[model samples]
Target chain A: MHVDINSYFATLLQQENPALRGRPVGILKDVGRTCVIAASKEAKKLGVGTGTSAYEAKRLAPEIVFLPAEFARYLDATKRLKKIFSNLVPDYEIFSLDEAFLNLTDCTRLYPDAQEFGRHVQQLIKDDLGEFVTSNVGISWNRFLAKMAGEIAPKGSVAEITAENIDHYFATTEFKDVCGIGRRLEKRLAHLGVTRLYDLHFVTDEQLETEFGPYWSKELRKMSEGKEPSLFAHHAKNEQPKSVSRSITGFSLAKDEAEIRAVMRNLIDEVMYKAREMQLSGRWAAVSLSGEGQHWWSHQRVDMPIRHAQELFDILYHQLYSQWDRTFNVIRWRVVLSDLGSWETTPEPWLPDWQRQEKLEQAAQELNKRFGLFTVRSGVLLQRPLIRPEVTGYLGDRQYVLGP
Target chain B: MYQTIHESIEVAGVFTPGKFSPTKFRWGKKTFAVEAITLLSRERDGLVPIHHYSVVASGTVFRLSFHPDNLAWFLEEVWQEGA
Candidate 1:
């Protein structure tokens, strides 16, 4: 079963403001400086959607209400909805902030009928999350079909896909309806004479492999049959991510090397904070800068697993400074720590000062945890306005922090 | 239009069995009865817990923030209808 909220952030805004109900509304990361992160149904009718610039959105919908995103409030709503799902099924995978999939193979027998069960789940969400908050529920044998069903389902409704109806659904659906086939892939498939989901059935495996890689070709074949790829069988389990990154956007390009270094320091602080929270260490550190019509990325594989933010910063500083050109203004900066492993599996440094440095880092972590983030941050971060961190969604490399 | 104003205010609410819900508040010389609590959220300011409330009163919505550290209430924002 797949449950998805409708216009998640924008709907939440309307749910909070009665004046916003039935009106075009869009949620922005900030009022003056960011793009539209989410748009309400009314706004969508005006051709305003996520990724639309605030200025463009206003031009499209003159009366569109733009509200800053309240992530803490949205997260609170997600938590409440999660509790409702917990009551329905014991096993579920949270695909994103507004979407989740439940494994009902073992629990479907508890209900008299699957459609009734879906309705019950929808009603429970509405009852618990106010009448304005609504969801689409989709029920099928696997996650992919269920998600597709939910996407095609009407707002505040449920759609169930079974073997009897799967072929009919695919015959009418477009290639983009499938989860993995995005706009780029859809265009690629179009060039291959596979414009619809039904068209995928006619393409040979070798042809698909030649166009897309071997992995995606097999996945597309399975999706064409209304069957999920075998790799998604363990969807419910939480697997450790291979990399964690933090990035900042919307800011102008840094004017000098010092400004860039300060931004890098702050970015590393955010990544390391999450790494320590997860108790993971990485062997590769990467730094990327984008702006002024140029994009540069540099990375270094360290001799030892880097656990502290300072160590990661040291590697990135050397790699970035050596190649950085002051002529180009850097509008965005990103720091990534990849090749991760459990901290317990990491070997300790043999230097005499290693223990002392580790103790200092631990103490700093404790202080920041006791206080708020960056309460004990480096001096380099203090030269500018504090870079507030946010969790955009599950897809980005940004840190995901739950609760208050 | 939304205007930002962080000013101290007084709120009247009920403390019922582990929860607090504001019913009215006074800012300057005017008192607005909270018709509905549109949204309520809690977030941390450093180590201190801050409660934020979005309330609609007299056909307008106001964002109220409460700081537990000093037990102070702040009128954070005002959204006048049709503004």
Candidate 2:
């Protein structure tokens, strides 16, 4: 069973503004100044989403009001909400911070119906916490259709997807719309001239094994007709990244070597900062610069992992700059920390008193975490600076990686 | 009610953002003109400090801090002094 906190973000916005109750609200999104992420159901009905231009949203929904996405705050609320959810429901998996899945098989006897279970969850979250809780239950014979059933179910509703009705449902269901039938599968199915569930359902076991990987293909056949294993608690402990990458596509494209070096220097600085955040070090790097003449040049390096953020930047920039005489005059350039050079084993190396600089950056990250970015930066970063550029799209944000 | 904190920290500015190594903030030799503001963001369930930076016409950089402790006061001050 899955639960959705309906309009999770919009509800947060309304919670902040009492007068905005039941009114149209949308989060004015920014990827270094780009688009909105989620909008209220009202605004959504008016065609608002991640890519909806501000002017367009304004035109479509005149009553729509804007709220900036406070990721840190929302993260806080979700943690509280998740804890409450975990306590209330046994064996729950967080689907998204805003959603959860609970295996109701064990509790079916205790709770008479899925409806009652859903309502209890809904009320528990809304009453105890300050956010809205809206959920739908899909009692399916299996997982694939259950997920689909959950998505299409009306608000505050439930649907049964047992063997009896699974066929009827898939007969009209679009293959592309199915959650697991990703684009590659769709293409393969198209090549085989099989585009619908019906087309795949009757295939023989021999053909299935030969065509797709025996394990996954076999699993697919079972899931398609509404029979599959329940998903287990699959949360993997979050691992500190081996490498952190930050890229920028300059809004004002660089025309020459100097600008490219300036940007490359900044990119190295960003990647190094993230490495330090995770207390990881990188032994290898893949740095690339792209430019106007359809020109692109990239360099890869292997060295001992460096944790001192400033020194990492200094080494990378010095190398990247040497390579950029011709290739860095482009629209986009990036630096990536690859092959995590080392783990958190040691602290900054000591140098002459005057040469000591690494500890200062470590202090800067903590200070900024207390404050914000650029509160303190390497003096070199301050030399001939470049402003962050904006990204314009529904899916990709140029400015997303260039952040704290 | 909203007021603007005029301090403009260089974001995605001449320097790349988040590309710095030693990802934490430093006091360095000089303290900022305005201390970073600190707040316990509900989202993070921890303290989040924001350093507000602004630049003058002459390209000199000035910095300020924003935190939970000073959020209300900062908002009020911005409102009063805002253009």
Candidate 3:
């Protein structure tokens, strides 16, 4: 069963504010951010939705109420919902902040009917989270079909996809309804005359590969047959990642060098903090920057695995930024530390400078942990707004998803 | 428009076994009687959980927070009548 909260962040806000109930609401990551991160049911009906610009949303529905997101509340709600899942199911996987999958093999006897199980979970959510908080449950034999079923289900309702009903659904559903098929993939599929989910069933695997490459072709074929190419337990708590990355899209295009550097430092600080918390370091580092139709990428294999933020920043300055033409505006930037290994495997550096740097960072980490993140930061960051550690609405951060 | 103001304030509430019902609060020099509690949510700051009460008072919506660590109440935000 795939349980997906409908209009999650927006619904949470509506649940909190009684006045917001039945009203069109657009949630922003922060005030002044033009992007609408999520839209209420009422707003969605008026064509406002996730990724809708604030300008476009207002034009769609002038009466739309825009509110800044409160991630803390969302996280709290997730915790409460997970507790309920733990009690009801023998096993469950948290798919995202607004979705989870429950393996009902053990509990089948308890809930013989799919709708009954869905209603029971919905009631529990309302009782624990709030009355306005509702979920759609998709019941199927496998994960992919279950997620598709959940997406097709009406708000606050349950839908099951079985051998008898899947064909009907495939014929009626658009190609985009499939999880991995985005606009680009949909366009490519259309070029091959595969316009619907039903059309995918007729296409040969060899044809799919020619258009989508090997990985996607295999996945698409599996999706077409209502099979998950990956294991059902893909949503299970992931092991310590091979790479730790932090990326951000600026609210506006950034042309200034200082602003770009400040943002880069902030992201590096976040990446290092998580690595330190997990007691891991990386030998490979990569930086990607893109904006205004220009993209640049640079990566290096360090002599030693590095975990300190300052050292990582120095490497980036000397190797990456110093080489950049600085011709294009930067709207998005990403920093990745790959080739990760546990601290137990890392050999101790013999240099006195390295030792002193480690000691200084450790002291700063202690202070920050006690007070809050960025309580102690570099002078360069002092002039910029402190980019505090914030959980994504998608809840993709493994460290936070796995929890303490 | 809602304004963020993390100023410590005095709150009057009834403490029951599992719930805390905030009725009124004193912000600056004025006392606003909470006509209704629109919503209540929880947030964690470090090890402490702060209870936030969205109360409608003074013809506006005011978000009041109770910090258990300090046993203090604060006026977190206020949505005014007009932007």
How close is chain B to the truth by TM-score, in each candidate? 0.92, 0.22, 0.91
Off by over 4 Å in 1: A230-236, A395-404, B45-48, B81-83
TM-score of every prediction relative to native: 0.93, 0.63, 0.91
DockQ, structure candidate 2: 0.13
lDDT of 3 at A230: 68
Summarize candidate 1's per-residue lDDT along B1-83 as a digit string, tens digits.
56888999999999999678899999999999999887777776367878888899999789999998889999998986655
> Which candidate order results from sorting by lDDT in descending order?
3, 1, 2
- Docking quality (DockQ) for each candidate: 0.53, 0.13, 0.49
Where in model 3 is the C-alpha error above 4 Å? A231-234, A251-256, A291-293, A329-331, A401-404, B16-19, B28-38, B57-60
Alpha-carbon shift of residue A188 in model 3 (angstroms): 1.9
Tens-digit lDDT track of model 3 for A132-247:
88889998998888888899888999999999999998888876566767899888888999887889878888888888899888888888888885644454565566788888
Steric clash pairs (candidate 1): A253-A330
Each model's fraction of native contacts: 0.43, 0.29, 0.36
DockQ of 3: 0.49
Please rank every candidate by DockQ, starting with the best: 1, 3, 2
Question: Native contacts retained by model 1, as a fraction?
Answer: 0.43
- Error at A388, model 1, angstroms: 1.5
- Candidate 3 per-residue C-alpha lDDT over B1-83 given as tens digits, one digit per residue, 9 for 90 to 100: 57889999999989899999888889999999988776677776454678888888876788888888779888988885346
